[model samples]
Target: MTRTRSTWSLDSMPDQSGRTVVITGANSGLGAVTARELSARGAAVVLACRDMSKGEQVTSSLPGAEVVRLDLASLESVREAADEIRGRHERIDLLVNNAGLMMTPRGVTQDGFELQVGTNHLGHFALTGLLLDRLLVTPGSRVVTVTSLAHRWGGGVLDFDNLQAERGYDSMGAYGRSKLTNLLFTHELQRRLAEARAQTIAVAAHPGLSRTSLARYLPLPVRPFIAAGTWVTGQSAAKGALPTLRAATDPTAVGSAFYGPSGPGETRGRPVAVGSSSGSRDPEAMRRLWEISEELTGVRPRFVPASAG
Candidate 1:
């Protein structure tokens, strides 16, 4: 039987004494909660944050925690952070791409992409490629990415013409595109990993509308509805992190297993294995997205060594 949410607890998690975990956007919110829960299980937790001071302060409170500066909005920062990780660790057991921005004012990334797309999707994409070798070095390693339910709104349609929102800014539209990309990216990466028979698994997860700082971007008019939804079914950040935690560490998790809350409306249950939108599973779109990622990021995920596969 699969492990249900009720079966999982920080205390019941597997002993991770020798394992290492890296969580992005670990300064606060769901990422921080996941870090704490994993650290409780004895994993050497690395908190990658945009703010050094915040990362340091939060990490100091957790056992076996380290802070690393990583601003995912900028490609330069992503490269630097990845290099630093390579220099620091000989092997990486798990990577949780949990950092994200929901909606933001019109802005362009250092790489000249829209801020939401560049940060939420592209940053994680580049980071995953950079760390593929380290993750593939060990068996049972996994890469878990945090997406959002907002992905459903886009129906997997990518407006490439306005990738940077050069036309106009629609915060929700930009956010939706980024999340849809996350799901597609996860599926595509998993397909490639399977083709190569790699040991590393790639999975996608979502918090299912939990009350996170991610909503700081929405317009004031919609805040009440979002808040009411949160009040009705929103779980705590720790609870919200269940799907991601499961994706990252659960033994039964396989490539392409998208996890999310399994309660009524999928908004407030403990983490449970779930399915992504059919639109996200489009192989053609997935392949195209992968190709675009390679071109935009200027890095391809190197294949796992045959000996390790």
Candidate 2:
């Protein structure tokens, strides 16, 4: 199969008929745009959100769209939502781990983990693990996790000892760590999937600097500065969603591949396969993080080890 690299956009998305896509945080921002377009393409889309009211609002506008309450901050909520999804759908063609918390006020989740890392990384880790069976059974299924440009900051370190940021905290630092973990998880997962010879693949994408509510947590003093930067570098939520949509649907996309904007600094443009920090690709860090995540989430993936395979 000859795979030609070309400029990819939303228009390039193929028809998604008979496919079921579950998108976390599908109520607004990039998630909403992704859901709307996928639904328009004839896919049965599930909006997994923390707020049913907001999810309902988004669902009302899109045909074949439904809401499932999923609070990523609470492992209990993730378990319940996964159970509901498994009960309803025999196979899941796509799972977009798009829900996340940006730089927010210092806080901890019900699970006693730092809010950002808990919601962005651990939550998605557990959800994917719980739903692995369904995905593996569905031929060509893919898991597209949403990361960020912020991942480039903070030296791409996992900081396991301070994983919860209890010793000290910097809002952006915590968020950066979480995003970095997203990439690490993607790499490790793809490795495991390949080892198991599963039909499912794990990929990742980033929205670049999109104008969305995810930035609402920025300090008031820096709001104007962020607004100006966004005005110069940011793209609309619809455009910001292209990379994710591409990662989810592009036939040429491969396991462990990352999609992001094609512009300078990858801030805004059409979607293209991009590179991540070398640290994100470190095998040792990836393995350790995977082990810690399994311990924290209590949802271990059923995959043959590389050596065993």
Candidate 3:
């Protein structure tokens, strides 16, 4: 019998009882909404944030929810959080790489990597590698990484030589590069999972033009224009959280597929399977980025190729 594609929504999510989910940036915006909804559905949710006070506040309001201190910009903090998570749970049902920085003023992580790439890509890369074993041992586990539509501006070139933007820095350019790396990492991870015949699936999602705190760093001159644009073209944080929730819970979602808004230019609407830029699908680039991430994070995945197995 042929299966029909059903319209997906938060109401369509399967019961998440007995599942454990870890979400970064759960203190506010899209991540917060995702955590609230998941926890409402009977899942045990971990609110991973850099600010303990904010994390505790959010965690206290939700049932079966707890807080963990995770500063993605610092590798040391990432390791400590991973060890704590491992000690608490033997298996993780879902991991949402949801925390990120937007076009902020140029800065560097504690590890000396570009702020955007460090927090958005490399940090998640290391965290996933550290938790991979638990994911592999659990049935029907998933890794959902949040990317962005700005990735189109990446132009398919990731200048590894100047990844830190030492020569020059353009806030938007750096942001775009980091978002593009997210897709590259997602694709590469899916490939490795397929090769290893692992049960854990890797997928990506974009929030489109959501009204979130992520835009707090917009230049003052552009603030009015952004405000108008968002007012007219953007969706609420709850709606923006749809694509991510769908990627995390949709039974039909497949590894390597990207989810985003279904409206014109993917600006706003219900979540749906969307197309990514051709450059985002370049296999060689994905592989190279993976190598660089592993080297930078020093966290190697425990995957064994199916042939080797």
Candidate 4:
């Protein structure tokens, strides 16, 4: 876990023998690869997925892996999953907020929030809050959220008044806003953790343009081009997962840090510390979004007052 290498890869990662990791949407795509690699490195991995059967299928072959049902679209399910996880483990070394929705047609979650924002941001937001106590008690715990390059889409705009897409809905626009929210949450959470002087830290990573099931909702006319583009420019799910793995495991990675592919435009390559959109780094916007998220999720993180800092 020491920081000695200039370039990080799977082989450079230190042994994770006693670490416990929980990852959402871990039965497929980047999540699955992340789970497999960590488990292979001797970490006890928990696959938190919407489909228990598929999670079981993935966990069966991974010796120390376990499955837990988790539907990020439903707050109730998130609560249940958190409760189950909290009951089962006294400490959570890492929590990967990897599950998300993409450019799907307009829809609402079970909790009445827009589907993209609900599943992509609010769900992870709520889950992190619920499990934070466990993380707080665990030394060196970290929360890694997966964002996207699409965060720069829609001009990096986040309209507070229209969080639920109540005014109008453009699928890609909403998705972009949600990704932006992910960064906001990560930055704000890291701030609060630092203020509290907590042992836990918050970080973020993006897979760049990996070819995953997330693009399944693309328009038919664009599907072929996207598929071809994946072959030409995108990395595989395993390769795309390097940033996440580095963010989650790198001993040198600090709170508010972001990891992503090092290639041109950050589309594909080895993992490295990366910068996010200017919008994502806005302190005022991050604070406002944090307040709104706490109000909507009705779960406030327990942090020592900043005056104590």
Candidate 5:
């Protein structure tokens, strides 16, 4: 089915007068910019970050925003953040699972999994499931997951045996696996939500390689090249936020849809809806990942539809 299309303009975007948007890693870069934009458009925004102090400092100058603590690398933190979010709001209009760590040293999460996969994908997976009820209760609700072009190269084969990369984990490999899982989760979650008669939309988008503080983990020398590449071609974090904003706030957005740039090689340009590879939609792989996710985080059971028969 062809989904409706929504174009994003600072003006044309939804008024969001009464909507509440929760953005992970909202203290900086794309997350921060997204929070600022959503706030500017008159939405109540919850900035979920690892540093409550930074979150508070950042939002102190911005109205219609709140700061809460979240560390995607820690399941306890994720659960605590979920509880905090659930307490203040009965419904959530938008949930932006936008926080991530890039190419960190080989390590495990607070839950004892490889850092990248654990934080980028698993943490958000649990958060989404925990908050699913509120999202379902909220009218016109949507979940926007931010991925990367590296996802094409980063998300490796779905490995059930070495799920955490505990055996010889490569930094970029784990990162790719996590991102590919993002799309897989997006498509599969949408399918399950539909079968359950849930009204929430699930969409995915990539920033198209912008230079942001999120990339600080890269070696200092490489930072120069990345900065040059982004400066030569990358858009500002504020501009890079369009795809997520479009996916989150755009009325035409739908479950399973992907968004990226309208520029050269989709590296930089306006945000527009896009497509994904067949690998991202493999049902068998997605089911395995879903089961593994539940096992790891103790989040909601993978959405079981009436048609599960």
Candidate 6:
């Protein structure tokens, strides 16, 4: 029952009733759209956002929706958010690592890692690890991380030595590396879940070139061109949200499967099962990134032990 057709839409997604979903960055853009859609289908959606006011704005229309403050750049905030969510919900059916930063000026997170990787990869990494126990115990739970086509940027491989960009910094390059880490993390997590024989699965998806406010951090000289390009080729935030929604709810979606727009260059259109760059498929790279993430975040997922013979 894999959704192979090019016409797959939100309407085709299975009913999500009785499930509890936690989505980071649900204040706006693709995150907001995803929160709305899943809530419509009867999910008790918790909107994890850095900005409470903005997050609150989106919750009024949806019954049973709650907002939790989550600042992905700060590990303390991430931990607090996870604790609050766990305190409120006994079971988390889905965890959408949807918050991210695009090409932005050189900076570091509260924990001092490079900004993009910190917020986009490390922050989500810690959050997932902290909240994993709930998901591990919940039957058929999933962790769906939203990655990007930019993952293939700047050669599509992670610069292990310069992951924090201490040697140098290129805005776009750092963003790409963080995204590459996202895919690598997803694959490695899936592998671990399989090894543990846990029911929780990890999957990845990308919105393609959706028109979101993520590009606000790009350089001034590049803003107009990027804006024009998005205007001409980008899909709405709701449309961009489709790939993530599909990955989150598609019953046929399995661990390590990726979803993205099926259009030319994967820029825009209906979402379908898509392949990641060969680099993203490398087992060594995934393992290394996972180890680094665990060390940096000081959090390791605790899954149920594999059955004994």
Worst 10 residues of 6 by lDDT: 300-309
CA shift of 2, model 5, Å: 13
The lDDT values for all models are: 0.85, 0.91, 0.89, 0.91, 0.83, 0.93
List, residue by residue over 1-309, the lDDT tens digit for candidate 3.
Answer: 122243778898989999899999999999999999999898999988998898888888888788899999999999999999999999899999999999989999999999998999999999999988878877789999999999898675666777777889999989988999999999999999988898889999999999988888888899889978997999999999999999999888899979998887788888888878777889998999999898989998988432343
Query: What is the C-alpha lDDT profile of model 5 across 180-257, one tens digit per residue?
Result: 889888877888888787777899999887878867776676878877887898888877888888888878777888
lDDT at 49, model 1: 87
Which rank order by lDDT, best down to worst?
Answer: 6, 2, 4, 3, 1, 5
In candidate 3, position 182 carries an lDDT of 93
lDDT tens readout by residue for model 1, 182-297 = 99999999999889888888999998868788778778989789888887778878789888888887787889998888777678787777766777888888998889889999
Off by over 4 Å in 3: 1-6, 304-309
Q: Which has the better TM-score: candidate 1, or candidate 3?
A: 3
Candidates 1 and 5 compared by TM-score, better number? 1
Top model number, TM-score: 6
For candidate 6, write residues 5-90 as lDDT tens digits. 58898889889999999999999999999999999999999999999999999999989899999999999999999999999988
Which parts of model 1 have CA positions greater than 4 angstroms off? 1-12, 306-309
Which segments of model 5 are wrong by more than 4 Å? Answer: 1-7, 154-157, 301-309
State every prediction's TM-score relative to the real structure. 0.94, 0.95, 0.95, 0.95, 0.92, 0.97
For each of the candidates, give the backbone clash count.
Answer: 0, 0, 0, 0, 4, 0
